[model samples]
Target: MEEGIAIRAENICKSFGEGDSYIEVIKNASFTIHKGELIALIAPSGGGKTTLLMMIGCVEEPSSGKIWLGDKQVFADKWLTRETRKIRREKIGFIFQAHYLIPFLNIIDNLTLLPQANKTDDKTARAKARELLKYFDIAEKEKAMPSQLSGGQNQRVAIARALVNEPQIILADEPTAALDMQRSVDVVKMLKQIALEQKVAIIMVTHDERMLPYCDRIMKIEDKTTIFEEQQLQKNSTHSD
Candidate 1:
């Protein structure tokens, strides 16, 4: 593991079935994501975009490959540890297309649940949750239910919740797909801000090319392999004219 490298994958492969029924999805994919970087993962439908993301997030195992989150090598042909769930809970944060905040829990409670479940004291967890709520500018909604907030507000809460654990890596899958253009842009900007401020690595799977400008780099899947490209961000040109 290299300094500041948050994720590293080498010769990773994934397939299903065997013999005549075998289907290969990804092959020989390799890449490294550094801390404080926001990367975009783009590919055609069913092109293993989410599959690769899931593998990195430890939700899906690679058929044969080596994966490292920070300095720990968690997989090589097989998962190195039986506690994949623990790894996810401790080292990774995940964001989905939908804001899956518990409907029964208020905004602050939704953020505190994971930390408390991970053994943090209730007072500490609530304090951290309050800090995140303030950071997201949703502090006034601490006691509001998910159903009471707008779509964008709930999504902000979702992003804040992902940060509550202070994980080294964040895996976001189409986080802004459900929002309108302006809202989507806002979400991407927020992600970029988080990566820089928290010094965390972020991999976002997106179908929208318009959001690429906000990312630090782009990772594309082609021919069952991975490609990396650097992004050219303008100085003070992130806004539309």
Candidate 2:
């Protein structure tokens, strides 16, 4: 892995079942995500996009191969440590297609709960949550319940929640899937801004090609292999003409 790379996967393969009933979701896949880049994982349905993301997030272990997050080698054939959950909590953030906010809890509390549960002082967690809400332009809605917020506001709160821990890498699975076109663009733009401003690497899985323009790079999965194309390449080629 290169210096400052937030995630590196080496020849990862994930399989389920055995013999005639077996399925290989990801095959010999490898890639690296650098700090501060917003990348999109693009693939068709049942193409292992979520499987790959789950593996990288450490929520699901790979059946074979190696994985690294930042400077730590978190997986190699088997888990390198028993602290996978701790590593995930401290180093990774997650956003999903749904906001998944606690409906009963207000926005501020929703963001505060995880960090506090992780042993951050209550006051500190509250402070950090407030800061994140402000950063995401949802500070005024801190006291509002998730159901009270609009779709965009709710998603903003979710993003704030993800950032409250100051994680180095964020894994987003179709975060804008349920939103309208403009709202989807807004959410993805927010993610890109967060990646650059906070210097956090983000991998967002999406089937929407319209969102590709906002990504720093596009990664496509095919036959268990991953390929990348830098968005800058097109701009550079155009400028050189």
Model 1 C-alpha lDDT per residue in residues 1-241, reported as the tens digit of each score: 5699999999999998999999999999999999988999999999999899999999899999899999999999999999999899888988989999999999999999889879999999999999999988999999999999999999999998898899999999999999999999889988888888898999999999999988989999999999998897741343432
List the candidate 1 regions with Cα displacement exceeding 4 Å.
Answer: 235-241
* Candidate 1 worst ten-residue window by lDDT: 232-241
Clashes of each: 0, 0
lDDT agreement with native, every candidate: 0.92, 0.88
User: What residue pairs are clashing in model 2?
Assistant: none
lDDT of 2 by residue, 1-241 (tens): 4798999999999999999999998999989899988899998899999889989989899999999899999999999999888888899999989999999899888999889868999999999998888887888998999999988898888888888899999999999998999899778888888887788999999988888888889999987789997785332221222
Provide C-alpha RMSD values for all models, in order: 1.7, 3.3
TM-score of 1: 0.96
